[model samples]
Target: METVINLFMEKLRNNKGVGLFYFSGHGVQHEGENYLIPVGASRVLRAADQLRYKAVAAGFVLASMKAAGNEVNLIILDACRNAPFKSGFKGDMIPPGLTTMPTVPGALIAYAASPGGVAMNGSGRNSPYVKHLIAWMEKPQLSLNDILRNVRRAVHKETNGIQSPGYYDELNEAFYFNQQVAVNDLAEQQRLAKEKEKLQRQQAELQAERDRLAGEKKAIKKEKARLQAEKERLARQRERDSTPITPTGSKKVFRDRLKDGSLGPEMIRIKGGSFRMGDIQGGGDSDEKPVHSVSVARFAMGRYEVTVGEFRQFVNATGYKTDAEKKGSCYTWVGGNSGKNWRNLGFSQTNTHPVVCVSWNDATAYAKWLSQQTGHTYRLPTEAQWEYAARAGTTTSRYWGNDPNDACRYANVHDNTSKQKNQGFSWTHHNCTDGYAQTAPVGRFKPNAFDLFDMLGNVWEWTCSKYEDNYNGEENRCAGRKSGSLWALRGGAWYYLPGFVRAASRGRNSHDDRNYYVGLRLARLL
Candidate 1:
């Protein structure tokens, strides 16, 4: 058997074609090595020394084939029969079946049964594995992998999961046993040539469209830069001509009276000024790039984020339902769970805590209702106005400074307290501890430079600007309610990391999507 296999391997040397070798005889494994039994062997040839001289090593066969350097090679072994030397071999000295063989490039080795499994010889002339393999190979247009997979499934099902065929394949190119050819070869070649030409033409058209879009994007960016420059110039002229209102003292604070004689949210006057928007301190996302100067007009912004009590007032007066309440769901830390809403967030929140689980649409509706009740133009702040007020004349990463360790004193970010309470929380947190684990009271932490409470933490505040990849004119103006666009969310939530709690960091969501970390702050034009 060894001499015959060597002679066969010489025929395949440097052939540059597909080669196949199949064996259907007894095989055995000794000391983790596979050997094939030859015909007319001695019945008592069970010792390792005697078998080494008569039996053919399977490794030698594979190594010789690899040296042949064929383009593709396949080896099939249906030799995992019951052990014939049970009397001579010790108990469990040799395993039931063959060991796994190492695979080489451009080769596939198939076994009739899985490693350490015994193959069953059917009552017919051949085994069940060989029967399925022959049947599948005769079918045209079936790749080699597909044929083997079908054989494995059929044999496993037929034997009730007792026997399973397996293969180790490293074939670089697709291979089919019986490939089909077109009847009219010349006509088929002409049709394929036409199809290729059409495909090339379509690709050319796509490239042209992409180029046109690129040009339009460049032009839009240029127009945005021109408008921003004009805005800054106009703002400087207005500042020189008119007296600026001092943003300090109690005179800048005011509250509107509702029809029921109740005072509305406390509003702080933000003095008009020009500031460079977007990530200035580095280590930010691409969406915060291409920072530009934006001049904000004087506006009154809420001193604190809208609390649950304030939102409840609006809902009671108008009998309104929030988006989360209407949809009967809200996205939380564990994901969107049914029966979770602003009222029942699976965590305790007092009336003083910031209102969460509110969508952009819900925030806008609340603002409109507040305006009707107080007779004032109240809405969500623009992205530019929110960043400018949050920064308050400083250019550091955070309003307090670049040090994140100082976060616990000024903001309720993810801290040691929350991490200790929730064992599953594995995110990076501030080393210091904030007293509360969940949403802290609106004014529990220190305020920013503008005297705004919870400007960078507790809960993210909704803005009226439509989200864009870069700073366009939309960041400076409020987006219309009817536009189907994602609204921006500024600040960071209590569960957010320190990197996201910066003035330049931005988050966005769809108009109707509600999240537990999002809330709102009112802004009024003066």
Candidate 2:
């Protein structure tokens, strides 16, 4: 089964057009994870782990499709018949029916029965779900969504609500099973015209709502500015009340003045410290091996990931184009989408959201521009410094703790909210919801022990150190930004799974690679 999936994935990678995968067999759920059972698999069901090893993991199939990066992919599973291992499995160890899986970008997965519900093996030749699916699929010009909706309705009626078809869709564009249009039919043409007119009306309504939201956003920004001014005034007053001190004894939080006299990003003072670097916790990757002690000098680091508003100010002042803008695209879940940059992400973003789609070079340039504006030494943190700050005196997988379930309180990661919004794509997400599907406003969640926001998730932060397979002296110092060097990226992004959101997890990309999942934070010599 794995070999078959691999071959299908390879074919999908080679094909630029649409791809479709359909399976008809027995499927089961083990501990909330779905699996498809191949023929003669009942012999290997002595243990739960054995079944896991033998059965085809539905997640692996979904992930392979995502990795293939096809434009449109469809998966139909008529495998929700009664469990094949009911005699061998005990209790809920092997559930009665298959579990639901998320859809990847530009893909959809349809099931013969609603998630966690059983389906009849069919008294007739075909199950009710498959029968309706076939009937609806043959209809011309019916979209996949429409066909599935019809199938669900028909199956519910046929089974008297005992079974209903289900689907997870993450497609950005409509896909029709039959592309033929009834152009000669006058009634069909009039119906199409009316549909187009209705779509235009909806678009107009959306534009009006967007305009209203824009006005509200402007008002909120003004209010936020007023509040920030008040906070700054209080901070200044407190500074004046205390004795002036050197960088080594500076206050916990401080901000520098920009060239326009506006305050820059809030900086948190990190005291000099020595600690073990690399994956202290077990289950980390090989790159995070060889844990060694490293000492960092006293410095100030950004309290939050750099915001869209902050990056915009630099762009406005310098008229600097980001690497994404220059390259004409940024990598997204769907692949490199043309014209998708920081200013024009496919989704909506407020000014407070952390700026993404900026490459390592762009990040470094922003740091340089900031240093010029503030007359302070600003740069990306060394790999060790970032890990140290992120760890914040913790030895756990994350500063919050080992359990990924508690992630919603500490950081914005792939969670229940994301699963609900991006119903396409399968991943093990945090058990909780952080009230955001994508990037949340910086500092929305609770900060770590070091009072740093989004150190683990929101967007991957670039470091000044080059990536190496194993720990060397490079982790402690900045590597020269020579071409073809792979710079290290710390933290994770909104779309990251539980394993990738750990403090010790490391990622690397070329300096010029711009992605929607990457951003930056700056550190300064205090």
Candidate 3:
């Protein structure tokens, strides 16, 4: 099979003439992929995995033919028999029949039957589909598309709708077979046929043009909506700025710790102030577009991220099962399904380490449980609140300054320790080392001006705000979920690059998608 594929590829690349390929054998379609069984291949297919080694993928064959530089190519498969290996398969039980191929320039793929229907191999010298196809090709001056349509009609009439042929064609130039005698008669027939095809193609082109214009109109409408959202956000910011400063309506600024019982993490009071939110550098993503003013009221935020010990306390009290624990899988930095979770993160972490692999929903549940236990309103911080705290009254890219060389002193990120431990494998890392490869113990790094630790790098902290493409005025408030929307994430993780640690950077994920680089930070009203 390999040799045959190689030879066919060679013909396609070197031969300038038309290439016609015909296959007549058993075939199967699984999960939208069609595979052709070679004559000498295995007959017993118990699972989709075994088929990979025993059959040639039709998509690969078509791709090779496309790159072969042939003026035109035709691939006909008469092997849509739905028998021989129809048992013992689990999951995505092989689709009933061969699927349709995508349209490619200068190429046509014709099947013996419509997609997902069994083609009758007719107990004779040839199948009805192939017999009619041969007869139609012999007829003079019939374009390939016309010939296929005629064959499809004849087969449908003969089989009474039990079997119908189908094809995907993108042929621009017309070519006909068996063109001899009565040259003028043949020329006139070809002219009329070509004219009809020209009109049909023009109609299709016109429809395509209309679709393109409609898409442009939709894009314009979206832009208008985004601009309106921006204007409203700016207006709200102006209103906030003109208003007097207050801490939850209290005139006095609260700078001390606020706590109830041992149910929730300790919170530090942040003074009420106004600052320019979003990316001030003008180098951020579209989501951070049109950097605008924002005013935040005083709120108590966790001094450090929720720790393993704290999360354990929540679970011990509530007997709650995390989404990852329930599903038995979590996404890790290496990739998904690395067998890592909050309990076992493939790294050494004491009770002091921030909890990882907790989904947004799990974090929200934890906050709710804490609120119930402490008799206070506890929830994930809003996106505005997170950025305000992370900035710590600074206007630079980071709370410290624009320079990233001083990052190791502020937070633990992908650094020299990670490079040496992972055999120099790093997506983006800093030159300095933070003494930890994965996650560091909570409060290991120095706190910002507001006494917030690990505010930029550690594990991403979940926010209560649902994610938006840009910061609309609505997102400035504690926005709720919109149907199936992903929740917003803030701060960068140890495995991320220095750029992602910027104060304005944002991330998001499904509410139930737990990951090793995602965790929780508690927040509550003052």
Candidate 4:
């Protein structure tokens, strides 16, 4: 796989556009860190073997789709299948499934389930996930994320709560398998295609006219050249002599950080589904243990994390202030003198900036407001859901790797000195960087393989689970159970080191405990 990824590097060139890759298989998490098991597994997969296996890290996915380089690169992972062999992996039952070539911009990646969650075994000859995914690939209506949502729900019902699906992506341009080819109406697409053909014919006629006039006497030639040019010019009209232009709003909108680095608005589709859910590892928390199945019906979920613009829409509609804005708190260096208040951050932020410094209440408020605005259910991703997405289709510890240094690329964490000092990793300041000084704009960095952003670090996102002390009483929690409901938070923030960002890193706080580093992203059923 390492050699294959390297080969992709050779083919990838600036200006060529996007790239994409998809993968599926076993993922392991320990002490809150995640790791994707590779093809040649050792008796037990460990942090050390990861370096040897050369497993794909989340950072590698980001660097490959560098927005500045080849347009955009996207990746999809269908991992998250429940597999045997956890603590000391010794397995015949476990199998590393499929993976694909790396993809660049003008690409799309889709996942079978959320990261860290398992996919259901197909009840039919083909697994439910596989059958539905195959169907999605054959059609053109569903965008990458849209079809996966269908597959996600199908497998959930097929397994009855044994697994959930997820994915990640970083695309510079939109590349749907089949977007409304020229807007939905068949007449519209045909009209556009005809217009393009007419322009080509006219351009050819004008070229011929110029050629015909070029042989005339010198003075006549000059005079005739002007005439011919005018005639040729009209011949290339793209609008078609009888057509009217489509209204501005009627045109399909496209958003991207294109070859020239432009940003624009893009429409999003919501996906929803039901699935079986639970951990294969024996240590599943009470809520995750016993691994019964669930039947999450279909619903919509955003394809990517909510942008600052999207969140602002909610704030504008509700006139609601997040906990941080209300409390006048700012993100502070864990030990910095400025850690006193939000005003200390020293900058006026905008609506397009991700709303940071939130508590669970703030996150939930935003979700509620969004639900009201869009008339759909919206809320923080559950712990299982968040992991499934964060993993995209991977199960690697930390998404990227065990190395803390590599995290700087995908997340704004303590890898650099100033950030480390602020969020608390002061001891390793040798290679620290205070680059942005504050949060860079959302999506400023690259995305994970699934096209999801900030899954590893940036802000610690709130989840829908209550934190528990241990995984000791597992069985009771798995059977349609409800334990502590204070809600747990997953994914590390800029305040912590990369190690803490590992999927296994867990934290608990009251619903009202707001901080400069807390924020939220939402998910829904399909």
lDDT values, one for every candidate: 0.81, 0.81, 0.76, 0.51
Cα-based lDDT at residue 483, candidate 1: 57
The collision pairs in model 1 are none
Summing lDDT over every window of 10 consecutive residues in candidate 1, give the lowest-scoring window.
Answer: 85-94
Candidates sorted by lDDT, best first: 2, 1, 3, 4
lDDT of 2 by residue, 1-526 (tens): 8998888889889886687878888777777688787888854454456667888888888887777888888888887754533122411124456788767778899888887677765544577888788889988888999999998998899877878889999998999978885599899899999998999899999989988887898789667755754664565456456734335444798999988899999999999999888888887777888988999998989999999999999999999998888989886543226888999888888899999999998999999999999999999999999999999999899998999977876788888678667633334678766767888999876678888999998999999999887898888889887876788889977887787788888888788887777899999998
lDDT of 3 by residue, 1-526 (tens): 7578779889768767787888887788876778888875633443578777778888877887887878788899886765343111311135556888685898889999888766776634578888898989988877888999999999999888878889888876876776655646878989988997999899899989988887898799667755754664565467457745435544332223225334346678788789998889766656776688889898888889999998988788778888888888775534225466788766677889999989888998988887777668889998888999999999998887887757777888877666556521324577665667788999866667887889988898999887777777745666565668777788887877676778888777767877777898988897
C-alpha TM-score for every candidate: 0.54, 0.58, 0.55, 0.41
How does residue 70 of candidate 1 score in lDDT?
90
Task: Tell me how far candidate 3 lies from the true structure as C-alpha RMSD in angstroms.
Answer: 21.6
Candidates, ranked, TM-score: 2, 3, 1, 4
Predicted structure 4: lDDT: 0.51
TM-score of 2: 0.58
Where model 2 places Cα greater than 4 Å from the true spot, the runs are: 1-133, 136-250, 334-336
Model 1 segments beyond 4 Å from truth?
1-249, 334-336, 482-484
Compared with the true structure, what per-residue lDDT tens digits does model 4 show for residues 1-526? 6567666765665446446555666544433333455776633343334533444564465455554356656665555443333212210112222333344445455555544344545424455677777877777767666776777777677667555555444444445676644478889789988998999899899978776665455569556645653553354233245445434463222233322343322322322333333443333233334444333333233334455666665566678776666665543433222343333344445555555656677677776665554555666666556655565444456566555655655666654434322321223321333244445566645455545667766667777665554433321121122432455666666555444466555555667665556567776533
What is the Cα-based lDDT of residue 418 in candidate 4? 45
Find the number of clashing residue pairs for candidate 2.
3
What is the TM-score of candidate 3?
0.55
